[model samples]
Target: MEDCLRIAVAQIPVTTDARANGREIRAAMRAAAGAGARLIQFPEGAASGYPSGAAKAMLAGWAVDWAALREELEEIAALAAELSLWTVVGSSHALTAPNRPHNSLYVISDTGRLVARYDKRLLSFSELADWYAPGAEPLVFEVDGFRFGCALCIEIQFPEIFVEYARLGIDCLLLSSFSRDPMFAIQVQGHAACNAYWIGFAVPAQCGDAASSGLAGPDGRWIAQAPQAATRLLS
Candidate 1:
């Protein structure tokens, strides 16, 4: 364990194609590793795009290929091991038939092992009604002596979640979202300031127009940010 750590927050374009999305994610991981980052966080649903409106209809109508998605995840895991980088990537987790899948963040260790998973508990109305199954518990892990917590989009509105993470003694919060709201940036910074912990806010490149992916310091200032609407890594 070291006294400091270098992390990368990615802003990548997400699409309906799982393989295409996986390719972008892998590219970012390599870039992060090349930049000397030990850990990298990605946007919400980085592996499986967050479907909505027409996209939702398409997914619900047999557009999703779970097998392909699984293969992509395996490849990503292998790459993480090769690069010796820890990764937190958002994706959809399938369940037994007739039950909806969970919106989840798969935490891969530097050894390329699927160490843990954080499922999104507080889902949007549409997510609950149609898209995903709610998760049951909060997730926390440690790397290089720093404790980290995980949270997903929409969960930002819940103060309790942040407070709980603070109580759990996390040194940083890894929050991923697919939203394009400007307030998300402000709220994430506020969370870091309030908790006196760092926060990596990872959003899709498309949403960068409103709020690009960034690392917020405990002082509520942006330490690093990816260019607006661009696919890049904030190291």
Candidate 2:
């Protein structure tokens, strides 16, 4: 691991097709690799729409499809191996025990190995808690000799998580989410700035709605930003 590792933030548009999204992600990873980035981050719930109401049906059936998820994750891992860039992407995942689903974030090594899984800890009161289970584990991974902490979406708002990670000596933080609220986005940015840690805000946006999709550095500045419309955010 190098001391001065460059990380790339990818800004991408979200579509209804998962394969298409995957392809776009693949391209973004390659581009980041070309940019000399050792690690890359992606948006939350990117595997499926950040649905509300009845649209939850879009993610209904695939809890046990670990094999398929592996295949998709492998695409990233292969890229990591070929380009030697560690990757993180948001996902639609299910638990093996009860077959429940979770909004997940995964870190894949350059060799395509699944390093860690962090489920979205905070679910929206309206749509999320009812559909997805609260994640049990905290985010922790190694990149460029630095121990990094990770979270999905709303986790960035709760200062406790950041305190815990900072006390544990985390050097950086990466977050993936699909919240479309600008206020929430600002909250995340503020949290990162106050903590003085490198934070990646990988979140999905609503079509033309007030949304935030971007990356934040330790100084609490926007490193990269995505439009409110369908798009990607890479920093």
lDDT of each: 0.92, 0.69
Q: Which ten residues in a row have the lowest lDDT in candidate 2?
A: 61-70
Off by over 4 Å in 2: 52-54, 57-70, 126-129, 205-209, 226-235
Q: Judged by lDDT against the true structure, how good is candidate 2?
A: 0.69
Question: lDDT per residue, candidate 1, 142-190, as tens digits?
Answer: 9999999999999999999999999999999999999999999999999
In the range 49-157, model 2's lDDT, one tens digit per residue, is 4454234565464322455555666676777788877888887675676645777877888777778888877776744545677787677888768888878766766
**TM, every model:** 0.97, 0.84
Return the TM-score for candidate 1, rounded to 2 decimals.
Answer: 0.97
Off by over 4 Å in 1: none
